[model samples]
Target: MGEFKPVDLFATRRDWDENPREAFRAYVGSIEFVQAGKRGKNGADTIRESSAAVYISMFERFMTWIETRNRSFTSVTQEEIKEFLDLRDENGKTRLTSKIRMVYVRLLERAYEHLNVDSNPAKNLAVGREEPFRRGKEKAKVILKVDDIQRLMESLPAAPAWNENSKNKRQRGWETRRNRALIAVLIGAGLKVSEAASLKLRSMKPKRVDGKIEIDLEIWDGTGTGMKHTAVIEQFAVPEIETWLRELGRMDLPSDLVFPGTIDTADELSKPTIYRLITKTLDLAGINTAHSGGRTLRNTYAAQQLASTNDIGKVGEKLGHRERRATEMYLDAAKKFAEDAV
Candidate 1:
């Protein structure tokens, strides 16, 4: 077979969900091929299809926003771009995230470059800075404390309740077991949500080191860059994982996916589904699920590890961060908490 190319990876045709200004639509369309096939200096395709789609979609939305204000691409100013960054719907919530803002800003910058405009208005506009205040109070980082994690764990049932009259009772039981195991890996191994979702059944193995048992979890970078690493699951989580595996064995499910969505499907659970699972678990634990999800668990794990070991390098390695500075935020937070306690 030829080199495998994912069917969903590229769009051969352009399909806009809404009609944009003719000029804006034409401009975006002119660069479609370049956007789809953009490569880095190493001649590797830098943009993924998903990112291409997002850029195109955001450009269209930006065009729509500008049209309402009677502005065209050439006539747009940096101030207008900043206003767009702050654009909110009728509910009074900002529509763009920092990531989305950066994408839109890049799109505008590229548009200016392509059009050979003398000056690029978006060049100096900063993205990703937090607003001075959300109403009045400072925005807090979303994290789960040790007590919150304990409550979340306690909220999980030991096993799904069996009802002879209920259809697919065994399947439900297996789902519960699998969910518990999934949360265990998220908390115990500090796996990212995408990493957890992409886990294969064979990715987990029990190993003993220095007379202590641990679960060896294989973590894929999830960026489609083909990078792989390993993280250790605490010994305390091993029993629940074993129970989940037993349940999977009983269901005769394939070993391809550790967290399959349905018995009929072999595909791994989508990231959104994994997110909802974490949120639902937090809700059940009586914790505020707002501004928190699976990442909160990862942060909690990082914070706990740093608090215990005070080793930044080890914590960074465990979290799969390429740089020590990425892990420093957690260490700083841990220190701040300590100082506050004192």
Candidate 2:
């Protein structure tokens, strides 16, 4: 093995203050670690691309799995490890995907440094053997059109199942107002559904200064929630959004979630629930494709924002993009605009 470089895991604290975490993310992304020519290149190149949260989750699970054998990662034999990798099922016969196994490899690679192992066994095993699985490109890229957005907004209140008239008129009105506010903040703020769903009452602070109310949105950067990007983009909240904020404030439950979970917990809305809500809203409007939910609205928000901008840099900043290059993904073709105008 080449001379091993020590990893400064604790160095995150110092770096976190001096640089934006996104910059650190970009820096980490630029690094390419070396691994020997092995059975394939699959495992060697997989770790860095995995999201940090996913990598951590996989590590925890894999560590537990190895516990049964009473083996630390360094002491495990290559064949034993490979067998573990090849095993399709756990004790319950639950099949593991190849993507998951790669996470295991990544965890071991990091853990081995603490063990001071001279040679890495998993480094070359099945390298280049399999292609990484990814979320569908179609799902990731779907965006709603302006008419679809209008339809979605219009369909919010009267959408049958959730809006049956068994309750008092005021209760129904409150629910409709809350839903509208949720949708408006989501679209207006360009929040990920998770971020919007996990919001808290304390996060929205309003004060009267010079006879005018000034609102400052304080977002919780708690784990697995909103991105710093979304918060940056939606820096200034307008009057309509504030009206919803006012409604949210009246509940006066300090610990309650601003958007409320399924049972009123502060937990963010699950992706499945968010997907169902968006799909149902669109389906009610008679739109054919409703499978693409929060993501579609998010993309539409970006595209519309970009279409209205003459300044790429401003849009990039507002969108909380890593760089202007990332903002190009939402940019519409200029040639189409020219042709349409002519």
Best by TM-score: 1
TM-score of each: 0.62, 0.56
Instruction: Give me the displacement of residue 202 in model 2, in angstroms.
Output: 4.2
Which stretch of 10 consecutive residues in model 2 shows the poorest summed lDDT?
31-40
Report the number of the highest-lDDT candidate: 1
Report how far off residue 31 is in candidate 1 (Å): 18
Model 1 per-residue lDDT tens digits across residues 107-171: 67766655556777876664333243222223333567667767877876467543434445255
Model 2 error, position 253 (Å): 1.9
Question: Which regions of candidate 2 deviate over 4 angstroms?
Answer: 1-58, 65-72, 75-108, 112-140, 159-176, 205-240, 262-268, 332-342
Q: What is the lDDT of residue 319 in candidate 1?
A: 71
Worst window of 10 by summed lDDT in candidate 1: 8-17
